[model samples]
Target: MVAASAATCLVVTFVILTWALKDVPWRQIADGSLKPIVVLENANGTPLVRQGPYQGPYISYEQFPDTLINAVLSIEDRRFMDHIGVDPQGIVRALFRNIQAGSVVQGGSTITQQLIKLQYLDSDRTLKRKIQELVIAFWLEGKLGKEEILTRYLNSAYLGAGATGMSAAARIYFDKDVEDLNLPETALLAGLLRAPSQWNPIVNREGARQRTEVVLDAMVDNGKITHLQAGAAKSAFAKVNPTRPTPRSGSWFADWVAPQASEVSGSSPGSTTVRTTLVPRLQEIAEKTIADTLEKSGEAASVSQAALVAMTPEGAVVAMVGGRDYKASQFNRAVTAMRQPGSTFKLFVFYAALKAGLTLSDRVLDAPLDIKGWSPENSGGRYRGWVTLAEAFARSLNAASVALAQEVGLDNVIAAARELGIDAELTNTPSLALGTSEVNLLDLTAAYASVRLGKAPVEPWGIIDFKAADQPEAFRVGQQSPQPVDLSPYQSDLVDLLRLVVEKRTGRGADPGVFAAGKTGTSQNNRDAWFIGFTEPLVVGVWVGNDDDTPMKGVTGGAIPARIWRDFMRQALRNPGPDTMSDDSIAGKDNSPRSCNVSACSRAYRSFRPSDCTYQPYSGERRICER
Candidate 1:
């Protein structure tokens, strides 16, 4: 009677297996077809960035270390090579354990059953699904060799750190290739298959080490390694420290390039290369500068945040620090933080004067007076009685700047800013010249770049080229040309005026020991401090402030912001070398103006005085003028 009952059970099992195997596509178990991951490469061809839910390249069994294979087999299914597909002993043991715990505490699936579930079955814990998994595992083993099945499983497992496969996991954890992994590293990786995130070293180092010990013990019990060998491997793994992946620099720049990536690569994925205008060296310098400055002086000054954006005159973004630390905050202050620009807006005010038939020689009153009941005063409440617009700009006199803005319509000043590529909304108020309106660092820096570019329109961009897997060549982007403008002469003169600010004026702290020029800005109550400067090769904007809009402790633009700007530029120019000048004053530089011959300067002055010194665009030369 017992034999007859067993025969009846075997018949039922055979019928269930036959029914489950009928619909399965058994050929795919041997033929590998998996999508590869997308890679974001820098200009240097280094694969430094990637986003996932993405798959990495398939690693074949031949490339895997024997220790890794043995570790997985010993922990996952000790009888894998001996059994047909399902290990009956493991199932009975799991059932006994679950019964003792009064819950399902262990998975009894063998490696083949696990592969079948991973490839073809849903994760439903039902008798019917288990039957299907068992049957499909049998058919999969028949079609694919043991090595091929292991390869597919390893290639498809989802590891942490945005990696999808063993090869990528190896690279992410140890920065090593799969073939270079030592026995301990291989064992650690093998142990993570059960629960990737829970056993991640960065998240739970102790848990991962404990899991590795379990795998090492299993390997020893299975005779894959001796007890002594297991102990030695565990000791080696414990002594080694893994390097965690650092947050990428220029994260804001990367965010800007994300959308453009799809546009260039079309719809393809896997191993994409994006060549951006970012100079990694410059990016590192910019990030370190902001971090060091804030670390050194932020707490005492009541400041807690800062940002920087650096670009070329042609509008290629070389370096950008969105904030003090990108991991803590991702909002790009350089492109999105719209705080009041303060005296930095004086750059646009003076540029408006130049555009509206006013020369640097023209005079503006620095003495305070009420303008429609809105009185403006210089920073220190002391002012030079009457000064050249050039001197007024260099000193950043609030009253003089406002008076000049009144002389030229507020609309004209806004127009001048727009022409220079500033797109932020400007308020049409008397205090607009004092930069009561808020603007982002990116636009302001680009506007300054426009001044240095001398009629070349600014269209700042981050990408230079892009390529995806299966593509023949990189798709070109970020190619820029000088846009035509009628302000060449005025632009040259403006450059000289800005030179004075860095040479011997309020912006003196921004001097980079080179022929650099820029402007300083300090908002009300010292809430914001900014310095936007340009050398021949780079235009950099720095802003230091509190994120909560609280006031700082006298942190003017010329103080911390200028020092950061100076430090960054000194490092940037130290290699390519700066165009050193003979004297500290702009008047003694080789490119100092000889005379002003522009009609506006001549008409504004009654007689030619050397004190009427201003840059004149004459015969394609910028000369200091006595008009």
Candidate 2:
């Protein structure tokens, strides 16, 4: 009777277990869907940066090395192949060990059982939870088979240092791939599963070495490898060292592009891929240029911070460096830090004057003068008497710039700057001519890029494409055409004057063999130095100074800033083509009027040169003039 009652109880238990198994979520179990993270790519389709914190790159079973698989199996589950799901012998032995120790010191969980608990069960340590884990483990073994279960286990396991699985572990620890891991590396990874943080080689190398030795011994004892192999692995483990983390090259650019990416890809919680306008080659060059320059000249000049921005004339940002080192500080000085533009401000003032019917031959006095009790003096307190606007600009003569600013209304100067994208607040003071107001390096660089484009005003853009797995094509993704502007007639002349600055004056240091034109800006007391220049295809701006706005050791814009600009531009112009022009182009004329006095002539000057003429402001009449 007792045997018959036991059989009936067993039948009831089996029926209940089968009924509970129906709610196991088989579809989700079959397709392991994990967290998705944002991935940023460069123009060449190389990963520039990763944004999301949770999920990492996924690797399939075929990509994992056999050594890694062997090491993991030997350490985590010796009877994995022989067991159906839960190992009864392991459980029995663990129960006895715990009973002797008077506590649960050891867990008898196989890899499959552990995976079941990780996915379905909570850490209650209750009898009910254990039964559920065992049931799910059996179901997983039956449904997924050994290889699929192992693959899921390998990918789902979390390693240390923000790594999720073998693939991420390989990258984070060794800067390598799973297939490339040596025996010691594989053993080190296997040791991490016991306690990821405690056994992480990067965190505790000595402790990790001891743990790796334990794994190597387990591999030998489990018959996965011979004792001779374990000994060789130990020797290799002693010589192994994990790769330390370093700042990535495009981190600053990535930060700047993240917001635009979010907008293009949608601000959802899941993973999105953002394709940026960054040219990896140019980005590398920009980062290296800043690092090399700072390593050499930073201490000597007392300049601890610098910023750079390079873009196409259409305003597609190709390269950007926010600071000397992103790890030291993430503050993107190029886009956020507003500093006195110094003589770079002169470009806008001259742009206004040229639009107001003033030619490069127009004269302004470099002698000391006062505007509203504000006396402006040229550098070194020396004056060149009366000089043409072209000569004054090339010399960066402050007094001449101030005089020219007064001739053209400050309102016009501000408007002209607005057209080129300088949106910073400017006081209507004579000091405005000397760039007394603050503007960010990015806006200032883009403003100069407008002149390079000649045909349109450039809106600076960083994102080229954005997408996610769900989307067909990227949103807000399209090629931008240049916006038509009224600078065509003056474009060649303006470039000529700028070319003279590079060829004969302050910007001479930035003169590369290619046709280059730019302006050098030195702020008051040497607090800021800037060089904004352009080749036919690229426009770049550079700024160097102290973060505290303190003055450097006489580091003028024409010196270190120009040298840095020249070095970067030389490398950028290495593959110059026929489309590129030489300095001789600066002498070519557009057959436009050399000067215009009437509003009609001024209007004509916007598109082509009207005949040269002088406007008699006092008499309200226009007169023809010769160059």
TM-score per candidate: 0.71, 0.71
Candidate 2: tens digits of C-alpha lDDT, residues 319-341: 88999877779899999999999
Q: For candidate 2, report its TM-score.
A: 0.71
TM-score: model 1 vs. ground truth: 0.71
Total clashing pairs in model 2: 2
**Model 2: lowest-lDDT 10 consecutive positions:** 581-590
> Model 1 over residues 80-190: C-alpha lDDT tens digits?
887888888999999999999999977788888877777777788877787777767776777776787787788777777666778778877877778888888888888
What candidate 2 gets wrong by more than 4 Å, as runs, is: 1-35, 42-46, 49-55, 59-74, 77-106, 109-156, 177-188, 201-245, 264-270, 275-292, 365-369, 464-487, 571-627
Clashing pairs in model 1, backbone N/Cα/C closer than 3 A: 593-623, 593-624, 594-623, 594-624, 595-624, 595-625, 596-625
lDDT of each: 0.76, 0.77
